[model samples]
Target: MALAFGLAWVLFSIWMSLPWLTDLGNLAHPLIALFVLTFIAYVPGFMNAFLLISLVLRPSSRRETPAQWPSITILIAAYQEEKLIGETLRSIAALEYPGKLEILVLDDGSRDGTAARTRDCQALFSALPNMELKLVREEHNRGKARVLNHGLELASHELIITIDADTRLEKGCITSLVEHLVASPPETVAIAGAVLVANHDESWITRVQQWDYFHGIAAVKRMQGMYYGTLVAQGAFSIYRKQAVIDAGGWPDTVGEDIVLTWSLLRQGLIVRHAEDAIAWTHAPETFTGLAKQRKRWARGMIEALAIHKPLLSMRKMRTMFIWWNLLFVSIDLTFTFAFLPGLVLAFLGIFWLAGPITLLVLPLAALWNLVIYRIQTRMLKRMGVKMEKSLSGFLLYAFIYPLLMQPVSVWGYFAELFGGKKQWN
Candidate 1:
């Protein structure tokens, strides 16, 4: 961490000394130029540089397996997931685990046939002597956090895992999660798994999202895990020590329940790690509206976490830096949406003010960051026997256009949370 910090500062020093940046500062209001340069360029560049250095310097080590795997309860949170619930259940049924497993489908008052379909799949998939499948029905529409708390009460084992109803696990995913969780340091109470896009071929939106998941989200989690605190034990697929979660007050009722829960655990100084080999494939939203809604919910969730866990800002730990890093995302998103984007339009119309040649200096770092992360993630996928999707168009859109759409949407979400927008679970 010290090395990474030094490396980041060194790069920042070089970036600050650029003559064009000085000129830009002179050309505009110094504060405005600093805002654009600091949030828009330096913070992101520093983070990427830190992640790259840490990954290269302290790569993940291979661990030996435990003598015996612990029994675990798997919770599937469902809400109008009739179409995808069966396949998800079957994937859990086919898991390659040695320990006794209990599968609970928490139906959160779905009007659809989710419960019936779970029952049908249960009959076919629960024949294994070591595993049992059951459905817990909530007649009223409670949110995911409440339903998960309900599942926690019925879990028979100390180890617990939460997976989304729309998520499908690879055959060895459970094994991988259990292995890593058991092998982690004693302070580690949770292990987040890798989630890939299953519907990347469905649309351009999904395609771009695939790259986002593969390059951005996964790489960030991997880096965070290296520091012994994976920020979000994402509900899509993650394992937890049951008592640890219970002590953390269970999942919170919020737009970003998972992130809040994770932060709660972190507040207690407990550690969380990420398991890249534990892979779960999920369906990305295929439409522009769907994508926007998802991103907005995510943005709102970050704000919720920041507001809820303000104490994290006072911690001096290496992992807490991620929380501080997230605080800057607000400014970064704001500048990109309101300043740099409009600057681009103006520059195209023959004005060079907010964004110009100086802005382009950040691109090489961004591109290199993407390349390094892609290589690391693809290597992990290959180790798991999954092939990388060959999509040039997806890469192009993700590299250029995806941010343009997402930053504005995230800004809208930030405002929505500030002004009391309605929250949805699905």
Candidate 2:
């Protein structure tokens, strides 16, 4: 599959580089534009193919255990999360760890009853004998990074685990993450745990996000782990060595503190590993409005991180390659979505002039590629024991339609970041 994608990408690149293909006069204007647009669309297809192949080929191993279980401080950064704070606290209180665990809920000046809700969950929080729950309230909205830094100061453990207020951990999440840190010694500074979509069964938006979590996000993390340079430790669920984070200047106040912190740790010669088995379930936005806002924040934050760390763009630094790969991935998605409508218009027009044989040949090929990807994804999910209530229709809708709808919003995010817009955490 990788070889086939490489060959296709090379051919597509060569075809696009031809002056006649891009030149308006060489062919009918519409046809010329379609050809160029088709080439543009192929870039993302090729990149996805490459990523899928990489994920399928990556090596794996059983989770390892450490000789000693280290103490951990779990930090939950919340702002106006009254509805969800109880669940988050309960999940942490249920973690099956024998070592001392400190759970800190930092309410970043929520006007809502988030702090009161945390206090209400005290009974559950106190149920676990080894765990202690503390509430840290801020006078103002200082953002996630600052709240995290404050939690860091109060942490009584060597490892600091940061999770969003809406995130819930699986039974052994903490044990699995901290074990890797202890076994690897000083080299491993941060470990990114896998995050699955929790509200996936609620709406189409969340369902699509679930597939994305499995194929798009987790697949990339798997490949990144092979290189020992996992770029981002998801803010929702990640474990960081306390001293290493402090040494790297605690999480920098950026749009994407997770990515910035990961890059900073790498700069200090610390390894970042992906813990595939350490799973956490997070609630995704249920509506398009919520989804768009989330994507915009993510895209803007990423751009902000890239701009702030411009020095890391040197190819001499390994982070440069990762950054470039990420940029290419985002660009391909943006360009392909923009070109789809125009490409389809030309394809319809060409149907009248071009032979039926050509149309039949191309259409099925495109459809087949999509089917193959879906089947691969379905099999992968079933193997991982992820069952969906909706069947093939849901998967198809998620794969084809969601990306097109989300692309423009992401592009808006890129531009907003470029122009120095603030991303509201709430």
* Global lDDT scores for all candidate models: 0.86, 0.73
Lowest-sum lDDT 10-residue window in model 2: 352-361
State in Å the error of residue 422, model 2. 2.9
Candidate 1 residue lDDT tens string, 114-171: 9999989977654798899989999988999999999999999999999999999899
lDDT of 2: 0.73
Write down the TM-score of every candidate: 0.95, 0.85
Q: Count of backbone clashes for each model? A: 0, 0
| Model 2 C-alpha lDDT per residue in residues 133-237, reported as the tens digit of each score | 999999999998899999999999988899999998877778878766665546888889988788887887887887777656776676676667788988899
lDDT of 1 at 36: 78
| Runs off by more than 4 Å, candidate 1 | 1-28
lDDT of 1: 0.86
Off by over 4 Å in 2: 1-42, 182-186, 317-320, 351-391
